[model samples]
Target: MGSVELPGPPRAARPPRPARAPRPRRTIRRRALPYLLIAPTVLALAAVLGYPLVDLVVLSFQDMTRRELFSGATPPWAGLAHYRSILSDGFFWTVVGRTALFTVACVAATMVLSLLVALLMRRVSPWVRTVMTGVLVAVWAMPVMVAASIFRWLSDADYGVVNWLLGLLPGLDFSKHNWFENPWQGFAVITGVVVWGAVPFAALTLQAALSQVPAELEEAALVDGARPGQLFRHVTWPVIKPSAVLVTSLCAIWDFGVFNQIWLMRGGQPEKDYYLLGVYSFIESFAVNRYSAGAAIAVLTVLMLLGGAVVYVRQLVHLGAAE
Candidate 1:
């Protein structure tokens, strides 16, 4: 019985464990990879933007004028005098208000229109979708200058296509209408141009985001008697929210600093009424030769933008947590 107990079933062999890299080395590699990947971008941006920013800040502290600029003479330090002047100027506050309102209007219009277009693209047939995508891509590829030029021509004071089209309607006479005569009307036209150019990018991005929404979830919601709004609110919105946030912030920043559209529309000399932060800075620097003041304005503008970005990011964090 003792001898019979010696020949039991053979035990299964275990595979040998592979040797692991050291934990410190692996941890360091993992930690450094992201920074390494982003190093080139950081270098490129610093090379391009870093020097100019430093110079701007230095210039803001100096009483730089055209005389000193052309003569290559170092301007005397003016301390915070320029900033004090800008802060005290009522016109500066007005421009800030105008810029903010303009940005809000343009961003709102662009997002609404873009969302509608994205939804339209999603619901259409394949062929129609293809054609729509093609059109959007073409639009997105158009340069800002070209788009602004086209819009300017369309809303020209005389012999404009917009006026012609409006004239075609009975009891409406838009012929020879001067869109820029009224600041409100001019701003409306500029907002249209901005929205037109911004919509394609936003719509395309949203369309892509919409594709990530699970068809199964949407179907289940529909099956449960969810209304279209309810379905979108409960299912689609959560998926597209991040993309929407990105587009919105970018649009806000871009619109807030809009210069070329207004400048080009006004033939490189935007009137006081049409002056945004960008134009105001440029005019103060180049037009009025108040370089120090202009630099101060520019710095203030950047601070405002950064503040807004911080607020927006905080809001997004809170929203994400609440969801």
Candidate 2:
């Protein structure tokens, strides 16, 4: 045993293992960084947007007259009184119907015009396309109020270019014709203005979408004896359907709440016969000093728009599933 122990070698020492740095602190910091970065934006939005919205909702539930507003008196709680008054009124329903009609007309016209413009752009030379795009951008950049004012001036019964142009036509005396005197004519004018303003944006969006369509697919369709309409229906349309839907939805939303052009052009005058929801809301809120009623109308308008948005989203989902 003593002789065997003498032949045994000593064990070598093991190296020390490196210690892992703590990860929990770093992980927490990394997670918190994004929230910290976005905190300012969230706070700003709450202050600017959230507060006004909350105030509007609160005001809607209170009977806040102009006198009360000025006298710093607390508005009495009206609960659903405002809503009931607005809903029970026949004029309110009429205004709502008019609003819906106007929105539908404007959206339809805008979509058609935009699609035409987009197709035209696709066929144009580069230089022509650039000039057309510039013109569209200029029109889109024009302020709503300014454009409305210009249209109002142009459609004026006296000293207007529209009347002068119409006078040039034989047996057509539009010099004394009042466009805004009639509800239908006023609606048409307002719809035209809105469509003109909206078409540029929709056209640009559609053009961009069209550009994404595979040229090879279009060429193949053409080679297969597909007519222009067939080629578009089968190839171009499917490719641009999403963008068209989006543009149309946006146009509908904007047209639904169109206030500036309508207000500037008509101002709910002529016995309020041509009144849309926006004009009616303004008249109820400011002109007549029924703030609560106006707020209720505004709320209802928002709900209607929300319903439209939901429908639009569902359509988008269905389209995606089809693909």
Candidate 3:
């Protein structure tokens, strides 16, 4: 019975289960994918902008003379000598004053004209708006060099339409008169060109901001015995204030460093009387071949603009917080 029972039960063997292959380890490329995607842009910026800035800083610290440049000799370290010379010069202070005055005038004029245009845009008929927009776009599309050249030709001492028109005035004798002979007049001309060139952009920005304002608010103000000026002051201004400030800051920055317009109009004429920071920088670098000095002027100009930008950004932050 025991032998029969042992034969009746036979053991069955089970096959072994297959092992799964280990998951592929995350490669270094997988971790750095985002940065890798932006690598080309970052490299291009570094090559174009970053390298030039570094070179400028280095050049500013060295006395890079024309001879050294030609001879391919290493420039000697000036060690802030250029900055000291720039600071000690009385003429530099005068140039700084002129630059400040020019910047202020141009920015003020641009803001005023642009604001007026923007205000007008809101009330104009559709056809008028189309025409106005076309004009603005055309003006904005005009090249800076082209605009400057046109202004130059128009204000020419001889064969200028502007001088011709002025000569028609009975008491005024501007016929073939050198408008650029007087420094103040030259500055005025340059300011006019800058303001004209800037208005289109400023107006467009402001109109866009104005469009965001609720129509009901304006109507409500008008219904409540508010005059046009009062409606703008109470209802419109509060909303557009940030945009206005931003435009002002941008205009100030652009006007402060304006070179082509001033240079093309009057290249540091009348004993450099109308020399702005931009003009001075160009004169020092190319005209006089004082590369380090020019670089110093450029650095200072950047600092000034940075200060303005900081103030503007702070004001915007405050406005946002208040809201």
Candidate 4:
């Protein structure tokens, strides 16, 4: 046995295993960095937007009178009394119609004008494009209040530039026209202002979209004996459809909840001409001291804006599917 043990081969030693590279350490900062960046914005929105929204919801359901609001009493459950009142109220319906008309008119005018401007700008020389852009910027740069003031003066019966210009025209009589006193004229003025204000953005957006149309595509259409109008319909229209829809959607949304422009134009006339949801709500809350009623009107307006957004989303989805 001893001899056998001596004959045993020398024990072979294994070589050392190579060391592995350490995995990258994830710090609290590294793991949470993305969330941290967004957390502040989320928190801010929660405090500012979220709190007020919740408050408005609660305010909408709970009855709040100026007297009760001023005095510190918990409001009793109004249920949908405010909403019911708004629904039954004749004035409210009138304002609803007015707002709808304004929205429609503004959308139509803005779309048509913007499309035309975009088309022209898309094909013009650099200097011409620059001039167009400069003019748009100049108009767009004016403050809302200033623009409103200008419109107010321009539409005035006593000293309107429009009336003056109309007087100059051979067939027109503008001796004393109160533009704000008539709903139709008021609407026209409002729509004109809104469209004029919106055109620059639409033109810029549409021009960019038009620029993306391949030159070859248009050239090919021409080679195929396609006239300018035919080429527009068959080629450019499809290419610009998405952009146009986006602009339209935006215009719809904006006009749906418009406040200052319409309010300023309405000028506090209880007459048929002087009512829009925004103006009515302001009058109710401030002039008449009907806080809950005003809140109801506000809620309705919000629903309208929300509806517009829903429509926009649907259009965008449809467009995506089409693509």
- lDDT tens per residue, model 4, 70-119: 88888778989889878998878878987888888888888888888988
Instruction: Tell me the lDDT of candidate 1.
Output: 0.92
TM-score per candidate: 0.88, 0.84, 0.83, 0.83
- Kindly report which residue pairs in candidate 1 clash with one another: none
Where does the lowest 10-residue lDDT sum fall in candidate 4?
265-274
Q: lDDT of each model, Cα atoms only?
A: 0.92, 0.87, 0.87, 0.82
lDDT of 2 by residue, 129-230 (tens): 999999999999999888888888888888788989989999988977888778788788888789879989999999999999999999999999999999
Model 2: how large is the Cα RMSD against the reference?
Answer: 8.6
Q: Candidate 4, which segments miss by more than 4 Å at Cα?
A: 1-42, 266-272, 314-323
Error of 4 at 41 (Å): 3.8
Score candidate 1 by TM-score against the native. Answer: 0.88
In model 2, which regions exceed 4 Å deviation? 1-42, 267-271, 312-323
Model 3 lDDT, residue 14, Cα: 78
Error of 2 at 198 (Å): 0.7
> Model 3, 167-225: lDDT tens per residue?
89899898778877888888888888998899999999999999989999999988898
lDDT tens readout by residue for model 1, 13-119 = 99899998568978899999999999999999999999999999999999998889999999999999999999999999999999999999999999999999999
Error of 3 at 142 (Å): 0.7
> Considering every candidate listed, which one attains the maximal lDDT?
1
> Candidate 3 — which pairs collide?
none
Candidate 4 TM-score, true structure as reference: 0.83
